[model samples]
Target: MSKPSKSNLKYKICSLLSLFFMLFFLFPSFIHADTSLQGYKEVFQDSPIIPFLNKKESSKENNKEQYQRLEDVKVVPGGQSIGVQLETKGVLVVGHHQVKVSEGAKSPGEAAKINVGDTIVEINGQKINHMTDIKPIVDNSGKENKKLQIKLKRGDKMIETSLQPIFDKKEKAYKIGLYIRDTAAGIGTMTFYDPKSGRYGALGHVISDMDTKKPIDIKQGSIIHSSVTAIEKGDNGLPGEKQASFQTQEKRIGNITKNTDYGIFGILEKEVNHEKYEEAFPVALSHEVKEGPAKILTVVDGEKIEEFDIEIISSVPQKSASTKGMVIQITDPRLLELTGGIVQGMSGSPIIQNGKIIGAVTHVFVNDPTSGYGVHIEWMLEDAGIIKPESNQNAA
Candidate 1:
């Protein structure tokens, strides 16, 4: 009955095109919002998505809360030389060996898909504690002509596999073609101990396997009192070390629970005493540490916690956890003369400034014997479970 006029037809067509474009652009925004909401639910509440959505706002709020909590944290700085003995959760596979049989050369460990960094915790149904523990099992499996069941830990996952042992005619023994170690022992200075919780931290770095250079998966460990016998004074291009002796089996002063990049954490079985420093001191956050005069508490001699002057050459006010939070230089004439600055065993020596424990010595500069790096006491405490940071207090 009615045909639209040309002008009206044009207007109607233009209106439809406008509506189409509007929905096309707006649809994506709606979908994106919904997808983000779903993702948020799938992630933990404390996930980084919240900050990504509003970094500036979230960061301000987080920093405020963190600084507030920092005011409430109190810890005692440690400066005692200690002996460390760590037993891995399982036998750590350090390297592989080639077994020579009548047929040819082969490695059973390699054939079983085992890697160097794997920790062998069990053989068959028996728990493996030492390298010796595997010998009998391997011999029996070889004699019985059965595949040996192996349980190992790779990262956070537990893996199981089976491998046939090869008989070595020369040695008259079965070989798994793997080099393993179950225990590690060393000496380090104690960084700090919490008088309240008995928790302590030391070695301001991970206890890594010397061969694989991987952090040890600790089953259990202990710390004992050690006495420094001598020091190989460091010089330019070479790092010095502290010669120490201790009775590892005599008595355990503490129990180790964790080995982290920041340090080793544990609970002290008894109150640790430092000869010159018996009283506990307050700890300072990374931000509170300043570039100026400071001191370090470390034992260079028999059972004595001596305070040596040092300079906080430069301080990094870490917004997050880091190993190198401060640059330190040895200023005490006695320390410099005795140890030629920070030595290997001097790591974890408590750095004190303004009567507060600010950080701990972590590393020595190879080219500069008198200078080294220090980690903030705050990060050490966090690693020790003495204080928990609320947000991105520091990044690795």
Candidate 2:
């Protein structure tokens, strides 16, 4: 019942302090339990919690970025013949002729300075979508003796002109002496098709008028199955062409939605069969294309889609979009002997290299039928709107 000595008390206090220090070092989590609430098992400056949270946030951002990427994109390589029918936005002036009037032979369109290749979009504030749409306006304006206010699209410019319709004695109707066409049709090859979306692209170049050489402004059109009837051999100075006959109504393929510099795009109503390349294939970026041997899927004769050998003479690693990205030459003796190299209607033939679709044949050299220019598939895919293009990036 007596008080302890100071030395013993000091020793006991020292032992108590030693025990507290040991326990704190051994079980720091139990001593500092508040650390758990802050998402940390250990109370340290470089705790793994911060790294884990940062990693999780980075992973979420990466997932979102990958969702919009084109790494999973695959397309079916097209090689069959397609008959394209393009209806213009309005009646296109193909030529100007003299109208035989009672007074004299004169051309109202020529007098108004309305050149050929101009698309007449409106007449007297009435929209003209077809060649037939002009007759009523012409007749009414002529009977009233009113000057026709013509609005047209020439290239990217919209122009307005006034033309006075003349009474044609030969045709017994009012005439502007402008030969206009509302529709154009031709045969070309298919480039690629996204099987998942049923969207397709074809004719690696724009469809232009033979006389005016201006890109056709498409309003609405369609494509149908076509059979190659014959092939004209190409020469150094002359380009060959494929003569194909469009199939019947049952062969209606798809409707043309857009006609761009990269070619034509549409949603296919039915799948286009590729006899050899039946499966979807991946496409290469422009920088990935290498100069070497390659193969092209195209029809040489009849309805048969065949593979032909070709050489990639050169390929450009483009930082921006371009229509011509590579130089190609026909090396297949069979193809050379058959079509005399890259001919017309073979513009959209899929160019494959190293098991990847690199591009499509765009144009044949006028001086060298054996060699031609090919466009990178990325540009065509971007124009087709299959993949979203990044700003200043070569491809999506």
C-alpha RMSD values across all candidates? 12.5, 14.3
Model 2 TM-score on a 0 to 1 scale: 0.81
Show model 1 residue runs off by greater than 4 Å: 1-69, 391-396
| Model 1 lDDT per residue over 158-184, tens place | 999999999899888899999989989
Structural similarity to truth (TM-score) of each candidate: 0.78, 0.81
Computed on alpha carbons, the lDDT of every model, listed in order, comes to 0.83, 0.85
- Given candidate 1, what's the lDDT at residue 311? 94
Please list all clashing residue pairs in model 2, or write none if there are none.
none
Q: For residues 1-396, write the lDDT of model 2, one tens digit per residue.
A: 999999999999999999999887878867566555344422422432122123333333423431124677789999998888889999999999999976779999999999999999999888999898999889999999999999989889999999999998767899998999998999999999886556788988889988889999989988899899999999999999999999544687887888887889977776677788878899898888998999999887778999999999999988778889899999999988988998999989999999989889999999999999999988788777777767327353
Q: Model 2 misses residue 69 by how many Å?
A: 2.3
